[model samples]
Target: MRNRLVFSAFSAAAVLAVVWPFLFGGQLAWRDMLVLDYPQMTASNFGGGDLFARNAPQDGFLSIIAVVMPATWVVKALMVASAVGAATGAWWLSNKELLPTLSAIALAVANPFVIERLLQGHWSVVIAAWLLPLIAAAALNGRALLVWLLVFVASLTPTGALVGITVALVCMNKHRLVTLGLGVLYLLPWAIPGIIATFRGGQDMNPLAAAQAFAPRAEEAVGTLGALLGLGGIWNADAVPDSRHLGFALFGLGVFACVLLGIRSVPKRLIVLALVGMGIAIFAWLAPAAMAWALEHIPGAGLFRDSQKLLILALPAYVAAI
Candidate 1:
């Protein structure tokens, strides 16, 4: 009960922190904010086409919500919920895994990757990130496959679906086949369309240029590193919210402590996972040639033109590692 309270309090705090600017009579407008314009929500809009074909199942879910509710409320609710969910999910995972409570919450909710994505107005990515810790816990415990299936369905984005499925399979040691089956069934909605689209010849894109364009900027990469340790901030000067300096400082301290703990106590597998995730993120920055080559030759690599997005896969590992 005490743990639950702590979790709830921190979760609420996390939500408030993210929305502080809005609470002060600010507005939500920037790249991708057009989705929040409620007037655009319509059946024709929602049913314009299959999401699987577009490889954005998550965006489809958001479109449906926009149609059903006022867009402003939907956006506000999602922003708060995503932040709270990420913190709560981390708290729950930490409790289940015997990790540090505060450290987990800090890394989960305020990670640079999450903040960057949020600032970038990538709501679907943020939502998927918030769900990752819970999904990891569920998979590890061999429960909630159905719930996870639903989450994957809503996540819709290839990165979200792939990460969720991969995590579940890796953690579900006792019920591998069952988990795999559920994942397949849940993904069919998107998979069938994606497969059909692939067969029909996908849209033309310069894979190499796309890869380079979306790779994390240097400051973004530094922020990703900081986030791995609970010090979440972005590289873009314009993206940082106002008056977050104290928060960033405290987060850095928390990250430093977590790093010490990780070196002393984290499991080998988790450390390896973190390194692999970091390596993938770095590959896009440090080895553009290799990244471009992989993007060109690898079948599904094209989907992750914004390879920095792969950092989402690392957050859960970082939490678990700490």
Candidate 2:
């Protein structure tokens, strides 16, 4: 009962965090929160367009459901359900350490970019973001069932879910392979659909074409060092020119802080989580080309476009850090 009450309080806080700004900014909506191009894809998909968000419209799983459901109230109901699930996941994964969990979620919430994502109806990001900690918890405990469940839901969003699940696994100790298997399992269902979507949408990243195009840009200052030092380059919400670019400076700082915290305070087992997270982080930061190479070579890998999504690798690192 105490736990339930505490969970309720924190959930309330999370919802308030998300809603307060909209209210303050005078953008509160009685119908929905599709603030920008969000409603475009939602509206279009409802009208039977599979060409939804070809240029990446925040990966609209929640919105897609809103379109599919018959009842008007179901959309709002599901939105609340997703938000509650995310909050519950956050609470369960916090290790009874309220401050850090609240801080982390709060940081994510207070972030102008994140707020903008909410306003723009990027419910998928918010939904995936809320699930990061729970996924980490599942990974740490070697909860195969939980891990796969997350992976399956995650694959639907492809990019963010992969990012979150990858980060969570990197933070685990006992079930790295198990988590990988789960990720693969979850992604398998979407393989055909994603491939079809890519071709139909013409958004597939042509590695050969990208490499050829790369000849002139001189890499455009995308080094991991520059990214890390720049606070994961998050200050520029438009930093990577797309939502797929998860390399925000705030995320970097969060991971860095996690590393320092692990070194100072966390247990050995938990430190293992941090170490794995840092390993993936360093790999992404240090040898980005190699990272890209691996992603390209790996099946279902092309679904993730930006190297910055590697920031999802830092979620567990934050868990260990805090």
The per-candidate count of clashes, in order, stands at: 1, 7
- C-alpha RMSD values across all candidates: 4.6, 7.4
Assess the local accuracy of residue 215 in candidate 2 as a C-alpha lDDT between 0 and 100: 17
Best by TM-score: 1
Provide the lDDT at 315 for model 1. 69
Off by over 4 Å in 1: 1-4, 19-29, 36-55, 63-68, 71-79, 95-100, 146-150, 220-257, 263-269
Give all candidates' CA lDDT scores: 0.60, 0.48
| Model 1 clashing-pair count | 1
lDDT of 1 by residue, 1-322 (tens): 7766766776677767766654433246666544543454333332234332443454455666667775556656665666766776676566443237776776787776777677877666777777777676665666765446535543555666776777666656677777678677666656666666566666676766776676655333335445433433333445554434434534554665666666544444345555665667766666777778887677667666666666666666677656
The estimated TM-scores of all candidates read 0.76, 0.57
Error of 2 at 175 (Å): 9.3
Candidate 1's C-alpha lDDT? Answer: 0.60
> What tens-digit string does per-residue lDDT give for candidate 2 at 118-144?
544544555565556567667666676
